[model samples]
Target: MTAVQPKPTPVGETFDSLNPATDEVVGTYAVHTADEVRAAVERARGAALWWEGLGYAGRAERLQRWKGVLTRRLPQLCQAVRDETGKPLRDAQLESVLAIEHISWAAKHARKVLGRQRRSTGLLMANQAATVEYRPLGVVGVIGPWNYPVYTPLGSITYALAAGNAVVFKPSEYTPGVGKWLVDAFAEIVPEQPVLQLITGFGETGGALVGAGVDKIAFTGSTATGKKIMAAAANTLTPVVIEAGGKDPLLVDVDADLDAAADATVWGAFSNSGQTCIGVERAYVHERVYDDFVAKVVEKTKDVRAGSDAAAQYGPVTMPSQLGVIRRHIADAVERGGKALVGGVDSVDDRYAQPTVLVDVPEDAEAVREETFGPTVTIAKVRDMDEAIEKANATKYGLGSTVFSKTRGVELASRLRAGMTSINAPLSFAGIASLPFGGVGESGFGRIHGPEGLREFSRPKAVARQRFTAPITLTSFHRRASADPMVARLVTFLHGKR
Candidate 1:
């Protein structure tokens, strides 16, 4: 007997989106209800059939057109991102450009990576011709974060679209305007098909998207929220890719370039007001160059300012609630013997957190353990590279790490337990379209961007065809007693000794 599933709930009328920099009302978006989410998925499901029918060539053409629109409108989208998330205009532009790269890469590579290809038949199945192909999962739900709003969400949305799946994207509540801008651009290119749709609301809207039973869900947010997303996705047996929060570390060995290490640490930790998922929240320095690095870092950090002004080096905190969390973390770290060389507890304002660097901080402080998600970093002096590695790996979250050692950069990077390691650069892994972006442990699972990103949006379909019949028939109506001994001998000859 079939069990009855409840009808989806209806979405609300409208919701307000606030500008993180000014706390001003930026835009009003429809609060998508469960019914709207389900309808979007159903419409996407229908559109996906036509889309997938287009195959790789036809779809790539459409994707290229979409890319043209995004490329032309990059500045406008950057404006929207700046208004919504309070990131500097340059940062927003850079992230948007990176997203464009992903769109182009996904479109260009989808056919080759996902198209049906012949695979070798093993000895046991030598008589069969086998092939594998990736099929679109139809409807994909994406819940994005506010930080790097364009780059982060498009990482999922573009790949899904290229893989022949329609998307129902729920952008971060803080940056729904940027989300709408993207949807509007795509709409201009693919008007006939509602291939990409946008819905906006708070947690309820996101929950509705999850319960809508989309083929898969890709989420980027905090670790605690990621667990909830997983729990919600489980109810419908929907697979999910979670690129949650991180407390990424940057390590400097004794033989490292102190100036370059300082520059990378400052830029990596303080960029975007330090609201990065893979931001360098912690740094472990070899005691030999510890003082030199700190001096250079402090000197460079002094020149950077956080504000909504045009010349401000950094922007305001995108989420207001994060201010309190950032403050609490700084206070806890300071109380635990950490000394803030720059901004401290009072640095968290209504809209921005000044770039802060702390030293002598305990490894157990909230600033080190928890994700501050602000422009704050904790620098610890370690006895050796072993201690640096130990302290770096001590965190529960392992997303990204940066190592600064000319001689042993690759070797040390290989030892760090992270999804990506920038040997001499900070956050360079994200810009490279070929590398996979994700994390391990509590940082979350699954990946988006690169070859893995395309696979995440599609399911592998396998096919096997029999060219000729062999004497040893395993699945037959008639019994073959002698074939069993022959099969055993073959298995022994192939693998028993090995």
Candidate 2:
């Protein structure tokens, strides 16, 4: 494989995105400054007013048109993703397809999820009619990640738009072209307003977007960076939805179908070259079936390879710097008495890192403890399901997990400490539009799908109307002294016994 080299920018303030597979420049994008980002936010705020004025019916119509554009020009977007990220064309297409579904679901359900609805009025306020409704939060700033760039960022952008907010999105420097494509397509669907705008650059650009006077900021990246975003947004008290990294784990039970469990583990751990935030980074197997399960994993992983070819199941690590991290993780696991059952440190090359699996890695080893963000997994043995659950939940990151047991799947899934867990498969929650996807702990907070996602970008507005005259008018300053005693007596009669 050729070394993945990036060419430096010329005199202008621009950066080149290199295809990790071939070390070739894919595209050039401007390194937007903070002021430029704020300008974009200001523009977005104006666009949001026009967008919000459309109401749910009008907005949904436009969003559906946007989805049609995406579906129609999917091939162009897929090739763009492939050129930038070096993933297989099929993977790129799959991500884009999933993103399309999410947008469609969000558009269809926005009315029910975020529209005005009547709220309850209790006996004490019987004379008043109360109603609660969701109002758009104006402009939202989104900082997206490179891996699953299309699908992940849309999880926020689509829902935000569905909830009646304009968005200024900053894609990862590695995948700016994809972001540009999306913005241009949306413009075709809604030509009158800049409802969706694109900003291209690196972390500094993202930091600027966080500080921009956008109503909300949705970020997806490392936990440490999530903290920085939260702190920076604090300057303006801007709300944010943080979807950070994760060291997701998969637990195999003694009663699990060994063949199925092994297949799920291999696919979950190595898909997208293991750059997934919710991918299986670690595994815990019941000791009763440890040897068999490991054998199956080895067999299933043997035929898999990473390359920029159609036959390959995956491609190179999108971020070149991650190659070193994958190497160090394998070396550390070996130094700490772990055994490499598959490709070892040598599996990692300048571009692609072959599938590597480690066994018996110490719990404290960097391979098991940290997010490797590569196509490697550390499998450990547990005496029983209880031990498996304990080991699985040990990580500081609680993003996603998988449980492979027929009888105890739900029970075990409930016990796992994660934002979402698959009962019999892997990463299923991500495909289900109704399921809100996000993480807890170091993985970050706030959801980006389903009803929760709709509300995230909306503010609840409540209204109350006086239906008739009340016998007790305690709210009025001119209320008689006798009314206070009567109210006290009524309150005592209602709640004194309980």
- What are the per-residue Cα lDDT tens digits for candidate 2 across 228-331? 99999999999989999899989898899999999998999898999999999998998999999999999999989998889999998888788999999999
**Highest-TM-score candidate:** 2
Note the Cα lDDT for every prediction shown: 0.88, 0.91
Cα error of candidate 2 at position 44, Å: 1.2
Model 1 C-alpha lDDT per residue in residues 1-498, reported as the tens digit of each score? 112111122245776676666666677778777888888888988888988888898889988898899888878988898888778789999999999999999999998889899999998888999999999999999999988889999999999999999999999877889999999989888888888998887788899999997999999999999899899999989999999889999999999989999999999999998989888999999999999999999999999899788899888777767888999999999998999999999887666788899999988889999999999999999999999999899988989899999999999999999998998878899998878899999899888888898999999999999989977998886859898899999999989995
Which 10 residues in a row give candidate 1 its minimum summed lDDT?
1-10
Native-structure RMSD, model 2: 1.3
lDDT of 1: 0.88
Model 2 spans with C-alpha error above 4 angstroms = 7-11
Off by over 4 Å in 1: 1-12
What's the true lDDT of residue 154 in model 1?
95
TM-score of each: 0.96, 0.98
